[model samples]
Target: MDEQTITGSTASEIAASVRALHERGALRTGDALPPVRELAAQLGVNRNTAVAAYRLLAQAGVVTARGRAGTVVAGVTAVAQEGYAPDSVLRDIGTGNPDPRRIPDLSGALATAVGRPVLYGEPVIDPALEERALAWVSADLPGRPVRITVTNGAVDAVERLLAQALLRDDAVALEDPCFLASIHTVRLGGYRAVPVPVDAEGMTVDGLRAALESGVRAVICTPRAQNPTGATLSPARAAALRAVLAEHPYVLVIEDDHFSMLSQRPYETLIGPEHRRYALVRSVSKSLGPDMCLAVAATDPETADRLAMRLSPGTTWVSHILQRLVLAQLTDEAVLAEVAAAGRHYAERNAAFAARLTERGLPTQARDGLNLWVRLPVEAKVVADRLMRRGWLARTGDEFVLGERLSPSHHLRLTVHDLEDDDAARLIDDLVDAAR
Candidate 1:
């Protein structure tokens, strides 16, 4: 082929040529594929088209680059995934805040989810999910100017939102000792974090004011069931925070209500319209089934549009099958009743556990949501370690700390009601010993 002739061909033609070369044993295993720029020059294709072709090959695991060795056929195989199981119970306590009652048997839906072969470029997400998600997210923010999008999970939504709103070295105000996932996401994105203090009623208004005054461009506040603490945003505090936020209307405000419908308390939206750039992320993992892995993020249209641009149905969209399954369960009156029942069941059980602990002289109190944030007389780590030695695993407050000073609260964060009766008894006994 003439050098001039080859350099002007389309990306598809170059790809075909590469495929033919590969099949003929001319390009064998461990052999370097042509450089993207060189291949584009030789095939007369645009550099971006060649890059795309290379990316497609990489995504298929057909080729991976080694430094200076060029892109070569990948020798390693991908690991197979084990089927998803509820993680709250392996020993059955102190993990996820899952309500066993919220999961409806989806035998029929599974058959439907499995019926068809999924084709490339076929919509990975169902249209019905978007429709129902619209109603679900906006239900609490009714008459407000916000748009909704369905993400694979709340973590995915949070990561993508942070990616779009903030860049490397940019600072965002986060709740100190924030949700573990939030801490991971911000640091992974290379953003500088400014931790604002939070208390029994959620993010402290004074701390937020100071952070804003320091010129943070983004703010992530959890309105209810603050992770690891279970604090909420009271109306008065929310109003006061809103007053402070009004001065910074242009800043992106993110309200992560991960424990939305499962909350024993009512939902109060702090991002009520008039704020220009705000997003509310609610996930079904805590309220319903964790394996469902779906979150609805409501935002001003501008942010939603940018997020939509970044998330492809193939790359990160929630499966249509899962979305349909969730909506079907959520819309069913019987299912809603069960979910409500689950909420009450969890609350009552957690209250009983708290009361029992109190009676045992450990002095723990139960609040809203699927977990209890317990106050301990001794260091939480010491208590948890003692419990582990007696055959229990639990999460300590230090795991949730986003602060630099290691302000370790003498507290243990535990999920309620996943324990067997004997296990619970043993736990209480060990806890009493640990406290004493």
Candidate 2:
């Protein structure tokens, strides 16, 4: 259909009309749409109305803005995922998963959770879990008021948090080479992602300042054991970041502390006490089994209420049974001790691997979290190819990167905490040869 036939009075109506055309196959992918000014004139609407409609379409992933090239019908963008490659025979080392043996047995916790008959009208959060979770999450934030809300996992909490505070096309500052799920979440939500580079000390101050200057509405940070890079925020750097963030008081800051119980590093936050909007999410998937999908988010009252509204009582509340089960494990001294041991185990194994690599001249460090970020002498793709030939599967750093890189990535993120001594040695030898 031509622009003359594309009719709608409001922005939503216009977006809906475009979607209808896309569904009917009338507007094929790559087809350029009329410019905003042209469309507004033709529809007798304000140019801002047309702009909003285009943004709505872009947010829904139905269309894309190509800068000077103009808006065009866009195809689905493929998102990189974590976990095992299907049916791979090679020794897989890229899966960022915690060791299964370390995950506490859930049989007893499950039994304890079964008797509670949660009803539709009941409070969405388990009272016992809330009290304990608040105490646990509140330890890091001493002066602020914190409210706890449970979700399926950290990813779910992030998605809901963004939804509550942001609209389509809102700019969000994300770490460069971010967590895979965070990258996926931002892309699917149709928000513009401004990458803030992360160094050994965590997110760079200059990078965050630049992002704030760009007018980003939200910022997602990892305070400890950052995914892919294992960069934890240093105390001084954390202070610097908080100073930068203070200028943009209204911008929402979300910190995903996914490795809370498993992290070897101490927590440092970007959200200052007077910050207007913020959320801290901690997940049990790493300490508890991933199957036990549970995360507790501590947010300001407004954010909590917004999140709670989305989580409506009988329909979307996280399973009380799961919450209670997590509570049981968190309170049990034996389980807590086991989790602590698991943290030490991961740190030791990763450290050993780093030592071996460093000795071999690769010069890698054993950072916090479940994986080691190793920089190779050569491009990771080339090394990964060579490693595959010798029977190994490793993830290249490029997969976790946000947007384009100035040069090829020479890094690989390896999950060696679970590797046996012999296997680890073999992989090290293979990697060195592959780099050459």
Candidate 3:
């Protein structure tokens, strides 16, 4: 029998053929494809066409080019979003989840949401929820005629925002040690991620400029309490970033203020008032509870319209009940106080843990957020393994990396807010021993 012909005339066509083969199970994950020259000869196309096809596939997360090891199908898996480690003997401090005890109780708020049943063909956003969400977001947003759209969560809003603005293979500027959800979203959407190095003050201006120069079409930034690193944008840093972004007014800028009311730091924005395309997403997941699954997206009119196309009523609007629940809790004075107290509690606990580690000769900064980003004196994975042997689980910094994996990571992101005082101290001692 004759071998199946890899038929294509252009790069896109060739890439489509490979995708078809993969989907049909003829090409399995980790399987190596034919060399560019050999594939070019087989398909009767130029070698450059084959190269472009491979590059496209790599950008789409369909395959990875391993230099001397050759390109192979990428085994895409759900990134660790932090939850229980089933049947593990260790204490799991790596789960990036807010303590359930701190999450505001919704029982009282749910009772208040009993009203006229929501019907199809109604407005996509709840009227009361929209009013409250706007007031909450407008306090920090630059004065402009911004429109609001409600979504399931911050990640959902971000995904839809990027989908509306960017095309496949379009470059997007993302923080180097980015959020796991953001990384997964960009990769799964077939967009090219341009790494912008972030510091304690948030995304570096030089890095943003470089990414802009590379023709990035969009940028995803976390202005406060950046995940995995706890970096927040300072006023000076925001100004520098805005100055850089001003030149690229049309490029989509998405600011995810996931921590919102729960953040210990002030809200500093990267989107200049005159910027043409921008979205500021504020989610209640952290302050209320992840199960609440509600976020408000304030964006330019055009972007809002585009987003609406995907979230129109009768199609995919956020549940009116969920919206009302979030609004009810947010507006309640007692709930608000509880959320504020929870913020302080997280900050205090993280600071205490960091201080404990510092006294052990392992300096750490617990700046802001539920997790502490600790730098290790040795490789992070080695320390992680050692901690695992001592019945502890920790997340390595490498898992949050975007773009190139050029060097080994020597940092760990630990969620210690849920740990008791004694447990935290024990973990710190074990961490020190492991680091040494």
228-279: candidate 3 lDDT, tens digit per residue: 8999999999999999999999999999999978999999999898899999
Off by over 4 Å in 2: 1-18, 30-54, 64-72
Report, for all candidates in order, the number of backbone clashes.
Answer: 7, 0, 0
Candidate number of the best TM-score: 3
lDDT of 3: 0.90
Clashing pairs in 3: none
Best by lDDT: 2
User: lDDT: which is higher, 1 or 3?
Assistant: 3
Candidate 2, residue 11: Cα displacement in angstroms equals 6.1
On a 0 to 1 TM-score scale, where does candidate 1 land against the true structure?
Answer: 0.75
Q: List the residue pairs that clash in candidate 2.
A: none
lDDT of 2 at 46: 97
* TM-score for each candidate, following the candidate numbering: 0.75, 0.92, 0.96
lDDT per residue as tens, model 2, 26-81: 89899898999999998899999999999889878889898889999999666667
